[model samples]
Target: MESNSSPSSSPIPIFSTFTSPFEGSSKKSDLTKKPLSLWPGMYHSPVTLALWETRSNIFERLLDPPLDAPPQTELITKTPSRSRMTIMYNFSTDYLLREQYRDPWNEVRIGKLLEDLDALAGTISVKHCSDDDSTTRPLYLVTASVDKMVLKKPISVDVDLNIVGAVTWVGRSSIEIQLDVTQPATADATDSVALTANFIFVARDYKTGKAAPVNRLIPETEREKSLYEAAETRNQLRKRKFKDEKKELDNGEVDKFEELLAEGRIFCDMPALADRDSILLRDTRLENSLICQPQQRNIHGRIFGGFLMHRAFELAFSTAYTFAGMMPSFLEVDHVDFLRPVDVGNFLRFKSCVLYTECENPDHPLIHVEVVAHVTRPEFRSSEVSNRFYFTFTVRPEAKAMNNGRRIRKVVPATEEEAHRIVERMDADSL
Candidate 1:
């Protein structure tokens, strides 16, 4: 998806309500409820969608979702600002086509769904931190829970049908969400598989990162709170681990898992210090060391600002993630300033720090990292913010293969801007 320009209050519409014929027929038109709003700003502009259509597997990520709920006919003047609601979805084409192939919108069409969700939750935070006190904010958490019918039959290639999704959240960092895939009405080849998902989000403090208490919770009303509580329970259930009674590691497997486990654990629980110890050291008033490379002049001899930015983000986050353990999610990135130019193949290294974290969310920790790339020939090196910018990362658990026997943890930044220059770069899901 193209970088969203800014959070706007424009209206976008979706259909969410459904009428049942014998209360058994399944179709987008049979949805029990219609979408709550129809704000144009909620939908992606034609230019953005057109650009994404050119990519592979990515086309599935931008599909439009079907709404069955009643559209909110009333127009309100209050539109909200943008929040950092990022989602990552992974899928196979046959599975997606089997479920939503004939539905029109296909693949990873989650960005817009998340954007609209943020609008419904009132004021939410998108950026990890605010300049005020250097505190972090909570973004809503989302998880998609697909029904069993689709889970039983994962679509494979040449089948023309597949299922693609993510346990994605695109609202306040504190809010949680889930999505599920379901089967079509009939098991016929012509029947288009129906696809829909549920969203649960909450508003949170921009600073002191806590869940702002619910001012109004109606027990009888089956609104967001009910869905949130249920999703939270389900999430907890999914996270449960059963001890392996007879699954002992064979000779070298234990040692290999230990090595990766130790490396990956840094991303989850890194300690802080001031003196130049390996992990956290302060140099001058800057906090940590950085390698600022001279501006790069391309291989063909032309200066490429793009290549420099990519390298800067990659090297900088590499250190932060290495310290955190897991592959970090790329969060946010400020614009860069290219002061001078350096030649191609000039070695560059980035120096950085674990600046004040997003104070609000202790669970979903946000590390503010900065980078200054320096050009290192056998002769010289310089350091400056002219090539400097910030990146955000959130710590998460590592995969079993990478974790070994120990509980492995790592960090993931949420935005491409924090690591990659391209807005359309594959997210953690693709990685």
Candidate 2:
């Protein structure tokens, strides 16, 4: 299948409902109001759909057996290098930004970028495992994690985005795809790397719902060797983290707050601390819930990871905007862990909060936002946490100065465990 020859020129309607999930008798004051114009374009934009369609075509080619292949062959075999894919999109200012904003790039637009990345990564995963030629027994792939995302600079609307994804490592069922986002050199600026991220995906048999094997990734070039080695290191770190989490659960060690406090770390009631330190986690939190629709499903009949990322980003942006009292520029997406796949028609609840904030000067403030996604069954009303996303943003100096150097509110952890988690995240961000 070929991608759309011409993308529609008209603007598309936003499909998401940007509203507070919390129910209350009293309305939030203007000081905490969400920006009315904070809208995402990926869900309904024709250009976005066209780009995704092109990606889908690539995926189809990767999975489909060659026409000349023997009819009796049960498995379709292809080299890993043949699975590599690249996509480029020319986004107009109107396509990405709200009409109220002068600049096209902002936290909301960054969310859209992340959404596209997730989609592309998921497609690559399916391609990597397409050796199975059984049409009736399809393979399903879901995003396992997104890590080591480095945002070199803010993406402007004036430049077209170039996204490249290639397989770097493959496990029995999991594969790592390194994605690089760049823009062509322009008259005003040289070609630059906008973002780089490593996305992990796991393949499963659609019928049995069990782990499926994928072709190994053989590195031939020196650059490929380095990427493969880096992926190995990251995989080790993920294992250690998972083991530690399991141990914590087994030991029933729920709170680490008291442990930090006992170690002479002052979590609260310090007058020397900045005024922003007094802000509670609840003060800068926001929640949004929606039912998954069929349109949001991928080829496997499950919710697309990119769609979930887009929704999560919007909530995080809202939380940061409400706390900072201004639009924030997206700096980095520290990590996103997808614990499990979400099925279509499941109700998803997104809870986002300002985890921490650092302000050295009134000119620039860094805000760390955490978002947790939960999937609930409509009948039982029981929910399981499905994903966790960490993002960093900075308030522009001009925006901060205009607000009279408004101090970005800090997250006040209610317990020692929460404090320790905050510190760990802070350290991770530094790396």
Candidate 3:
């Protein structure tokens, strides 16, 4: 565990997203935090104190040259091992849920972990693209999308956590980084793997603002070769999916949507005819909006993708909680898309709803939630989707029983838009 004392050199600005560190004046801006009627969960954590202590140090570091611009040079091929990185948290030595990343429950807050993963991936992408011998960051990098993140095992805050990653694949401008989280073998138990995540980052020239070719990746080991191949396949699928979305209106999609609309209409008109209890998809919806803050900006000065993920995950959890009417345990985060970058001062709106549910087990129903983030400019009368998030959660049987034994209500799409969203999820699974 990191002590309260600050490092001599600047460490990463880990908590700058929550508190304003660079702004000097006290003038109230739209980005400033304001009073709210109600705040949820255990918001007070020791991390706040850490953030306060590091704010000044982080600001001083921000004064240094960003070095984002690098002179264009001849291409050079590099091995993936050159960019490999492994970061670990020694929480088992001295730790408490309130001292580190945790929520109302004693379990780890997945939202915070997602932020850490993004930071790590960003660092790796920088390392992979840099040709200079010095450690100064050079290339402009931004997260493109995330393939998938599945939690195979529950992560406990008290255990020493290890995050291992390396460059898996590369293109003219984009690079794929694979990160795996695990716990080392303990005296009592063997090593336990928790989750794996893949982050795609696109490299851009700071001056030309064009796609910057990265150093070619050469796999050193069999495992590395396998990973490279897998990433290539994933990339191919992404391209194909994008092409499919651009095709002209086909009968296949139209006919499928008609069936969904018809089924939804019948269920809405005759509720008693449903095989199991259900609810309208709109009823399971929840939303909140925020003014994008400069503190949350990435190195490129745009809103951080990880920050967006954190907000989207929280909204998705709330949607599932309302639908289940009980506290839910997070299962996994499936595929997600970062369609566009969100700029500072943008009115960011997050809309979430229960997309579907599995009630095979009445007590512990599986809930799939979707969250869509839009950057709305009321001044220009423009609202465009910037990202899409998908999350899965389930409630404990005992907790469900406490809700008067109300089984999870299956989500029925009543509108064409809703039907389209549901089909998108179904298609994403195959991808």
Candidate 4:
């Protein structure tokens, strides 16, 4: 099969419209009745109460069975390969930021797009595992990792978004889903690739909470074979990286300090920022904390992964903008690791800092921002790291030229360990 071939010629009916349970009822009096408060001092009308409940139920039913709950049968038929599972979403004005449409750099929020990708990948995983008898037991899936995501073009507000997700590879308990974002060609132009991503999800038995087996993906077409092979290559890389990280931590065989010293020599010869009152990493650092609200909860009643990712991205973007003193175009999101699940009502704290920057050319400056999420229990004043996100952005050339041709700020590591680690990670990413 061709890479761009449609999964099927017929309509896949991947999405289902929900009919509100209270759709056609002579409930004018009931609608006016006030419902109990969802929280302290937060009451809602009966109409809102009904709608919220119905919406939540519809989302849960459409997605997957509630976590730790009894298994429920799915309505859709199952397929073995990626060809049968496909999902597409159309973008609307609601997805765009007001007054930012004209700005080339300020297009659709990458956070929002990532959220949709996560949802679609999860949906595809479920469909791949679902079969006639398997539906009797619920299989819970969670995103373990999002591989490097590259954005080829900025997603404008007016164009419709075409997202397609399919199972590329599967393991004993994990499945890899490949998602491609594109804009369909119109009479005026041709289709363009916007972004591509690979997500790995692990299945768990709802009752036992143990790793569960997923159906194997049988690659019948050339496209499927290619995707499968790519997934395998990535899987191997992940394993190797993990092993190397463990080895480094255990033995410290590689001298990161020496590596940093070598790299520092290369940058030392470049123009120093001391000539101009330059910015430092501390100057661009930002910290934000907020309580996770119920609205951000997923069907499983835990904080949504996409919500966390969006928050992290926003913080990273702010850091990049502040350091660059210009609007930065998002280039790509590096590997995002979801360490643990966060519960609702927890205080989530985000700390963002400029990890690396290079502006020797002045015309083309690169900025790398890192955001780490921490979940805290306010009562105990205790916090645990939840996730880490790395992002890359490039500043507008014109803006860089406007600031007296000043060089972008450099991140000076205060501690030798930190300097070594940062340099090591940067070098690894380059490889």
Q: Ten residues in a row with the worst lDDT in model 1?
A: 141-150
Per-residue lDDT of 147-176 in model 2, one digit per residue for the tens?
Answer: 857677666655456677778888777889
Per-candidate TM-scores read 0.28, 0.75, 0.79, 0.76
Candidates' C-alpha lDDT: 0.33, 0.65, 0.72, 0.65
Per-residue CA lDDT of model 4 for 210-301, tens digit only, reads: 88877766777777788888889999999898877744432242464554444444445553633243334455679999998877765556
Kindly indicate the candidate among 2 and 3 with the higher TM-score: 3
* lDDT at 35, model 4: 27
| TM-score of candidate 1 on Cα atoms, chains taken together | 0.28
Q: Which stretches of candidate 4 lie over 4 Å from their true place?
A: 1-106, 132-135, 184-191, 248-279, 402-404
Q: Which candidate do you rate higher for TM-score, 1 or 2?
A: 2
* Residue 243's lDDT in candidate 1: 39
Clashing pairs in 4: none
What stretches of model 3 exceed 4 Å from their correct place?
A: 1-70, 96-98, 133-137, 184-191, 246-256, 266-276, 361-364, 401-405
Per residue, candidate 3 scores C-alpha lDDT tens digits across 37-121 of 1112112222322322333233222224255634547667776776676665666664443245757776678897887678777
lDDT of 4: 0.65
